[model samples]
Target chain A: MKLLFSNEVKEHRFSLKCIPHDTDMQKIENIDVSVFPDNITGKDIDSHGNITIFGYTKELHDSFGFDVEGTASTGLKDFESAKELHMVGMYKYQTKITAPGESVLDFSKKHSLESCSSNEEKALLIMQNLNNEFEYRQGCTDMDTKAEEALKGGCGVCQDFAHIMLSLCRLESIPCRYVTGMMIGEGRSHAWVEAWDDNRWIGFDPTNGKVVNDEYIKISNGRDFRDCLVNQGIFTGNVTQSQTISVIVNEEQNLIHD
Target chain B: MISYMDICGKRDRVEDMEIYTGADVVNEQLARYGVKFGIYKNNEFKEQLFPFDMIPRVIDNKEFAYLEKGLKQRVKALNLFIADIYGEKKIIKDKIVPEEFIYAGSGYLPQCEGIVPSKGVYSHISGIDLVQSKDGTWYILEDNLRIPSGASYPMIVRGIERRSAPSLFTGKHIEDNRNYADMLRHTMDYVNCGGHTVILTPGRYNAAYFEHSYLAEKTGAHLVSGHELIVENDHLYFIDYSGRKERVGAVYRRISDEYLDPMSFNEESVIGIPHIFDIYRKGNVALINAPGNGVADDKGIYYFVPKMIKYYLGEEPILNNAPTYLPYYDEDMKYVLDNFDNLVLKDVAEAGGYGVVFGNKMSKEEKEKFIAMLKAEPRRFIAQEVIDFIDIDIMEKGQLLPRKADLRAFVLMAEEPMVWKSGLTRFSRNPDSFIVNSSQGGGFKDTWVLSQ
Candidate 1:
């Protein structure tokens, strides 16, 4: 059976409502987006039989960052599967200039654009740099991450990789977008990336330089990974967070009859 | 001849008494011990409740002796075939079994090539399923050489059944079936590294979790998961609750070959103890059923078991095999394609009762699709004639009903290949259902081979 793929990119404008409104007006400076689109190829279709499109933004909007509230819509398509679907992606909004004298642009510049290269190369360099620069320590970053802070700590997972790469892409003026997609590599998990080069955004595995192939199936996209959040809703009480992602790709043969 | 009345009177003397004319009661008692097996569905654990019947199918001593000889001969031949496939490829040269069938089988593991196992025994535990017809004859149904389960259930059930019907035991001099634990222990001891025996389980949530723990407890072996095992310096070691390290003797691992070694078979396996295959390869530890034994268990390879028995044992097969058709053969492929609706199609690579399509159960379009699939990848599929064995009564909805069932009798090959006197008798719950696999909503009964 041919697994249905119904994701097409169309123009969209989205808005967001930040919780617990920040009263300090001086902390707000700039707002920017780093998302883009890419064309699908025959090779992008997986051998185990599934269509995967993983495109994301790699830009950081720092200076003049406002206590952002509103929606941003883009020309993108929604994902659906007739049988079952395994989707993983993230949409994030990085709050810039949390304190006085810390300009949003400086914070963004300090985190973004340290290296300018192809997505694959950049991902490789980032992994080598992370391995050389930081100690392999866990519990360093949470959902609320600052690229500047993570750069100082020198250790993070794919989320941190996406955040740091987004900041850099934004500094470079690349129309990078944050993408949430299912990674059918050795294991299944959500990964983030910045798309640039005429919306033909390629994925950068900052943890490793493993290029996103047909195995990486896109779920959703936005400015950052937090924007394309899979399960994000405020609960009534103190919630200890726990998450699990399982993706099964089976080899399906479709005998096309004339 | 002792009639049903005599059996009922004997069963009445026991508590929680239920007199079954056949083997189904044994399966019921096994279910009480929580001895069930499991299979994977979409990467989730699903337990299999093998349906069993109460009526005990009596095989006279003379017939059983012949069957015992044939089963041992068949298992020995299979072990030799595995050795040859991994070592010499002599059978292929002799033109007995085709070479492509061995290589094309998904169960054929290239990693096991040239690596000899301890004691040269590839299939230590074999669960060979057999069925008997109403005319009083038995035929081999299937062979499960890789980590076969259900022995513990019968071993435990016999204890309960004997206690429940003590008089039944007094009249029959049935061979004691409790020696399976001792047999398994000795098999492990033959390949031990001077440490304690461990039953390696995937986890508590696995479908065979109950059996893994049950077997471990019954055999005086520690139940350890993949996380509890560590390999250092090409030697296997187990981590204890007291934070101590002890060398592991034998691991009757219930996990598949791919998930047993992350570094070897599948790099993404989190449930596997990384670097453990290296220890097995180095002969520092023994893997029960042994990795790569799947080469023999492949359903496609099953067509040659009788031939294999003849080749290695230099003897004719005592037990008869159901007529099986391998699509890989040109004539067989043509036959299967022509008779798509008459034969049952099975994917040789799939087990736990998945990817089986009965021709009678499908629509015309579905049959066409299967035909196309067979033509496209003939090696991946096999066709078999549906066996219409005798059905026995099972309790359901407060009444007895006849259900299709089969028996998986465990044969332990430590000192010598010995069949467990008790077997797992599984039956289908649905009256119309022909597939009695426990994973497909079946229940089990304890099998009693009556000693006349």
Candidate 2:
């Protein structure tokens, strides 16, 4: 059966009041942002399925306001009367693919299935079977939803599908990871999955049975969707602010001409 | 006459215990065994040199016997109190302790109501702090019913001390203090669910990680993290390296109650085992120092322990209190407000040596602010008269000096409450400091209760 892979659709908006503390305001220079890329395909990445070249940041890498920055004063301070800042972003993408024509039990039977059978191969088989059986549906699951729940539901967004696949892979002893990025296609935003096959990592679009190609751009990789959300913040101001997001995805056709 | 002052001088008068002091010293003993404890400051992990004084505190047999009875009685009453608070609320209903005082206290959890522990005991291990007055009267300082630490320190330090002070042991027959591991193993077995026991830690960065690892090594329990445990079909299991799963009999978890189960307590807790509470509720596993025990350890509830002893055991308290005043009571509130400068005001909600404001240390503005807070939230605070306890000499910058010290004695309650022969004796590093908390720059010494 042909498997349908759906991209994660994240419509998120937030406002942060950056209060000028005696310490933090002077340290604040410029805000760096890494928006999920647009216009990408499934064939460009390695087997482990990692694409690190997608998310872009203008600010110095040290000032990215995350744990890598190691700044004590990174988050918005608890201050009064500060005009709270707001940011909004959204994601959407889809791929059509065919599942590998082998059940996990059948695949294991062909393999040694001995006492020395590697956990990694077992995990790959499980992942392959899960992708083959489940249909990707948006808004059917959330970020906190576990893989077992997603599998039981049989339909969920890219985040849920990836998490379910990753968890099953992990259960089989393979180190699987979640990837957040943009696919160059006729879509608003996108996300996908990466798995470690043997010593090498590989990326495949379960939604559209295709290897990730150079057309794909990568943003961040984590255990789940909660780790790679584009933007996260904390603010103290009482008044809430509204946010809106817009994205345009198109393939760069004239690569040699440019 | 070898006065106590002379013995103190013999220990603290030298640059190091091995060179100057005439005591039989085991040099670099803890370093040899890789025995160390960890503490956290400003979110940074630091290893602390486990302070050991060659001069151990000696309590006569009679004094120890009396202390054992009082400690056992106190722990039993506390366990009963916790069971009652979580199940029947009988203590509150009988007006022995105020219901508002309990509900308003942050430690009380309504979610834990009607949930019974495996052995009907709330505090499997209790660390109760006490101090000796100049007149030799013992006073109860506080109770640590939830995740009490430092038992392994005493257990490990005694091994080193026994090797060094062979003469000290010959004169005074001290009972074997090595049965802590056996006691702990038996305690876990008492509540076993037909599986292996494990010590759940929040990982190596936690302040009590050393204790967790040490106790797990000593008691033959697996030291595991949150990622190691899984819940399925309302049963808790540990996933081994070979992918073989084993049911967990008991879990002596070092993490706080709130961080034990993400689904039941704090949803945002990443270090918690998800859905493990359901397994514990289903009687598939036992959680040592079970959840909702904080309600019994509340500082407000501490004031009524003597009363609880009378109410539950119909016996008088052997140890006295240091004149604690609960602000929730009208007359006590008035008394504390009138004499705010002479007492120590402590927030009932805070623990581990925080939220304590000494009346004498507060400035005028601070006192006023505290008074305003007292008026705003009366039940949240308590005041106590500072007891002048006897000072002991400790080594400081290679000098013999006197400093305030206190003892945190462990009371084990399994089938019954049993006090260990030895306890942890902690002293303030500063000469003028009265707070001997490890968080507040204190050092610990070996306690030896001599047997007759």
Candidate 3:
């Protein structure tokens, strides 16, 4: 299956670096990008399994934009054979992004999620539980909001849903990470999770209550929401600018669906 | 066998004691030179002088020889631990150390995974604290791998003491500690890939700002702030006061990992360069102590260092850690509960003499409350047997009194692990206090390693 994923990122008073990285399930077919203002050379793969794009810059005064489009073929994975094998950097996913008074294990016990079940079954159950737990209200929480807070408030965006699910999965010792990517149909950008099973990584989007398919393309993954940021800005400008992201996912076969 | 030699100071104990009679005069000179610690509590800044003692803690040449060897071996094992945790993780896989102990702590940073420094050196400078018990056994306290400071205090005070007491210096033989600056420069230069070396400071407001600036001047490296450094084209460039830019090859960054890059770690950090971490990841520049070393020195991870020495180097530990027990294990938790009143409980997350509780001193009601909290969060605490460490004499009201002291030995990992011939011996001011931290009313004495 072929999928096209692209996003347009703009910088205002602060400059942004739009990173191009590789993911597990899909391999990139072709990368089309235009970096304006400046570009730096050299790169390496970090311990987190992310390919670092080094020395790309957008200076102050004018807004520089990056239009990145990539085509990839989704491949089949045998997640069953991956278990009982030691994975380097697995400690990265086991970390809990703690918020004040956020006891994920206590919440799990409250929901009786400690039953003897397979890791995937537990992950799917968590996704289903969180769909009912959250009201799917946008603007209810910001990017820095923790899952424990969102669960208590009863409303959050996809980012919060992913965090809540990540906390629950880590409590069960199931390795999980946060992923920012493009989903099929209509949306600006999507936040979801990828759980490490025996032999492969499986994606679960609790906000939509479904497993991600070939139509989804992962941009980057990290232990928490702080790591998967597509565009990061650091500048000394005194101006406050409101920013927006534009994303479009196109499937190769234009199949009409009900 | 003593690998190196030191010169013995000819003066006896009484003559050395006579030289310290003018300690008050030397202390007043310290205030004039602005040798102070700028402390910030409740968001308010206050400056206080880090008082110095004239009496030196003298160590024989043979004793220094043993300490130097152990310091090298311990730092070597620690560096290997950092490398393994980031890359192979064989220790975790073999079940030599529990994964929960390594990953559960706040110091373990996942962002630092896979970033090997220029020379595979994670801790360029390791400040290993050691305490001598009353029976004369040296016990390891804790390792300060990430920017272990206080090296500058002795480096600066020596100049003042040399000028103030010329008569005292002529009669005694002492190892010159002024070569520390040269050692530091060599360590930084050893890993340089070609460009200039710069000391990147968080700014004057940071606690270790004095050391940062002092070291920059002494080593002849450019002293730069975060604002003065920029990441462009995957290279770190230092901008001069005239606004000219030059590529930086090695950077001794004097800031925490969380505050090093706004793009990588803390998004709200205004004092960090945005893409500097990316530059480091590309291997274009070298970070002094490397990021993600906190996991190795964490109070929780300290329990497994002796095990790391065996796993990484296959050697018995030269130095012994103070008898410690972690509550994370069921057996240790049981021992801690059974001997609650006899042990000193320490919160793993706290440092600088904070979060330490004497179980014997707690009231029964307070003890019950603490035990409940300890049971509720077992990983957050560790229990240790209090060692009655020996004391050095200090002049309190012109009368000599014994107070607990601890030595912080500076180990530089450059051309092999080079332990400084001398160390910073800090003594507590309060008679009963065991904590000899400079932050907790502790004054420092120069450690003299005899050449005899």
Interface Cα root-mean-square deviation for all models? 20.5, 20.3, 3.6
lDDT leaderboard ranking: 3, 2, 1
Candidate 2, residues B1-452: lDDT per residue as tens digits? 11233333344336544423423254367656655667777778787666655555667678988889989999988888887776666666677887655654667664465678787877888999999888888899899999988888778877876676554455456667888898888888888777889999998778767789889999999999987887654567899999889998899999998998755566567787765665566567899988888888888888999988888888998777779998878899999988888899889989878898899899889889889999898888889998888787665546657778888989887889889888888888777788888867777776767666
The list of candidate 3 runs beyond 4 A from truth reads A1-24, A35-47, A51-64, A75-107, A110-117, A238-240, A254-258, B1-17
TM-score of model number 2, chain B: 0.93
What's the TM for model 1? 0.60
Which model scores highest in DockQ? 3
Question: Where is model 2 more than 4 Å wrong at Cα?
Answer: A1-258, B1-27, B32-34
Docking class of 1: incorrect
lDDT for each candidate structure: 0.61, 0.64, 0.77
- Provide per-model DockQ scores: 0.01, 0.01, 0.39
Candidate 1: stretches off by over 4 Å: A1-258, B1-33, B36-57, B164-170, B397-399
Better of 1 and 2 by TM-score: 2
TM-score of the second chain for every model: 0.89, 0.93, 0.95
Give the TM-score of each candidate: 0.60, 0.63, 0.90
